[model samples]
Target: MSFCTRFAPSPTGPLHLGHAYSALVAHDMARAQGGSFLLRFEDTDLERSKPEYVRQALDDLAWLGITWDAPPLMQSAHLGIYNQSVEGLTSRGLTYPCRCSRKDIAAALAAPQEGAPHAVYPQTCKTRSMVERGAGDAVRLHMDRALNQASAGLGFIEDGPLHCGVHPIDPAALLDEIGDIVIGRKDIQTAAYFLASAIDDMRQNITHVVRGVDLFEFTQVQILLLDLLGHTPPRYHHHDLIRDDDGKRLAKRDDARAISVYRKDGASPDDIRLMIGL
Candidate 1:
């Protein structure tokens, strides 16, 4: 298959140096193989995603000389697809409705167990029957069943080298580290990041996933979801994250580092590329 990659960015804030780096890297990778590159807008977070931000993000990418195949795919416009996916999982008994709020989860995980994240979920609603599942609840995939399916004689071939941190193609380690994660948000009917992303990748037929290392852990969840949903897992290359002088990851709130601000300061595309070492 021809190489296919995407630079999916949420339109919740202005694009920053980190966004530029990720876009350029994915663009270069696709161009190197004479493949296709797609631009996807991850606007599932309705509370924050704005039309102005979406326009600014597109402008930033174009200013950086990154061209996509067609108009970008916006997550908001695909709510029906996401709903269908959720229904599929729910109907198959692969997902259970979660009613626990943030405080409830926090209180439950007061004591963290070994090998679990500090904000580990105690699965308070895991055993709740479908009859009690309500519209206000979030959908959580059955991790144990998904993992069992993922490890049940599953394998795939990568066209190129797999480079994600220190480990090399350690699928077992990836699964063990990443437990059950949210696939659908309670507040929003739209799919959560992992679920929407996996579905988008599959629908777009993305051959490789290029993003920052911060998302490396989430890849395990994605891989498991794709396997359970009968979709091919794309080859992944989780690059090092862009950090500030204080060794902190760049965030959308860093207005000073936003690409729009840089543009206003008359920074050229080459300047942005140089800044991100592209």
Candidate 2:
């Protein structure tokens, strides 16, 4: 396939320097490969995503001289597609309704057994039968079952600073570590970040995925899902993140590091490139 990559951002807050760094890196990668660059909005969080944020983000990208090949793909407009994916999983008995709240999960983790260092879902709803399941409950993928159904030793290639090679997916480690991750949010009636983004990447024909290193681990889960769904995984390029003076990753809440704030203070786009070491 021809090289195709995307810079997808949630319109829940202002565009921070971290966002700019990721977008610029993806844009540069596409341009260098003489390929297509695409823009997308992960605006599924209806409560937080606003029209103003979307408008400002578009302006910021334009000001940075990052041009896309096509119109932006909005996540909200494609809810039906994600719903269909969830339905497919549900029909195949690979997903189960989860009624466990955050507090319920925390309490379960707090009463954990010895030798368990981290807190993961205790699979409280794992045994619930489909007939007993109803709406208004979050849906979780049966990771073990899904992985078993997929081809053996599933994994993806990483082209990032931390891990730059092919890492095979270990079903045992995933089951003991990540557990059954929630993929369908009952409140939103849409798939979670992992499911929605993975499906969108394949649907959009993304051959190369570029993002920050923070999402590297989640890529494993996505690759598993893509494989189960019978789609080819893309080459992933995870870039370094922009951080604050305290060495913490920059977030949307950090208005001081927001791209709009920098632009308002008369910082040129070149200055941004220099700051992020682009």
Candidate 3:
């Protein structure tokens, strides 16, 4: 495949410095490889994602001198594709309906055994079948069963400075680490971040995934999903995060670090590149 990468962002809030860093990194990598750079809106969260925010995000990227190769994809408009993926898993008995509320899950975790490893989902809905699935109930992937069906030694390569090497997946560890994670959400009839993003990565023909190191831990589960779905995982480059003066990661709440604020304060695109050490 000719190198291709994407910078997918949720339009829930304003674009911050961290978002700039991530987008610039991916764009730069694509340019360096003489390949394609794509953009996508992870707007499945209907309640949070807004048109204004999406519009502002586009302006911010353009102002920063970043250009995407094609028109961006809106995930909300493609729920059917995600549903098709969920159906494939459901048909294979690899997914089950989950009705556990956050409180219910917390209570279940609070009553866990002493020697339990990862404090992830306790599989409260492990035995629930799709026939019993009610409206609004979340659908979770049965990690163990899915792993069983996946090919052995499933993993992806990392080119990031922090963890630069090939990573191999451990089936047993993923069960405890990721557990039976939700593929379909309880709040809406859309795919969760992991499933939707992984599906897009495969379908978009993305050869590289560039994001913050904070998300590196969950890469294995996505890789597992891709392998189970018979698609190859992409190479990942998890970059260091941009933090505030207080050593905290920049968030949407931190308007002081928002890209728009910086732009309005007379920061040029070149100034941003220099500030972010690109």
Candidate 4:
């Protein structure tokens, strides 16, 4: 199959050096394989996503010689598709309406339970009646129920620089750790990152997924959802992240590390590559 990958960035903040490293890695991988590269704007956070950030991202990518096959896909305009997927999961009894607020979840997780390594949402609203799914209630996947329904082992091939191997998906760990993750946040009127990105990958026929190592754990959740949705999961490449002098991962909020700022400082695209160790 032709190699296909994407560099998806949320426009909530400026594109920083970390973003540059990821985009260039994905871009170079696609070029090496003579495949397709896609640019996708993960602007699900409507309130924070800015048009100027989108433009800046495009300009930076162009300066680095990162091109795409077509116009960018914006998640904001594709709400219906994500909503339809949410409805499908709900109809199968794999999802439940969550009425608990952040504070409620935090309180529930304040005390760790025995045999559970980490605290997760107590599933306070998992058993709630679907009829109670109101205008403001978020939709969460019943992880246990979904896994049982799947009735098979889930795994993904990793070809990245770090931890490269076929990683098995542990449903038990997901249930205990990431229990009942929200799929559709009614409050925001947008699907969660995991749900939307997974759906979009399948929709775009992505053959390879290239992203930061920080997202390695979340890949299992996406693989679970993809299998439940009957879509073939793609091969993954979780590259090393760019960090600062203190060995902290770069954040989009760090304007000093923003690609635009570097461009303004007479930093060429080649300089960016060198700085990022490309």
lDDT of each: 0.80, 0.88, 0.90, 0.89
| Candidate 4, poorest ten consecutive residues by summed lDDT | 110-119
Instruction: List all candidate RMSDs to the true structure.
Output: 2.9, 1.5, 1.7, 1.8
Candidate 3 residue pairs that clash: none
Model 3 TM-score relative to the real fold:
0.95
lDDT at position 153, candidate 4: 61
lDDT per residue (tens digit) for residues 74-160 in model 1: 999998888788777777777787898888777666745533435546677888765677778888887766665564545443333
Please list the residue runs of candidate 4 whose C-alpha ends up more than 4 Å from where it truly belongs after superposition.
111-119
Over 163-204, each residue of candidate 2 has an lDDT whose tens digit, in order, gives 899988877777887879888887646668889999999988
Candidate 3's displacement at residue 92, Å, is 0.8
Measure candidate 1: CA RMSD. 2.9
| Root-mean-square deviation of candidate 3 | 1.7
Candidate 4 lDDT, 217-246, residue by residue in tens: 889999999998888899999999899999
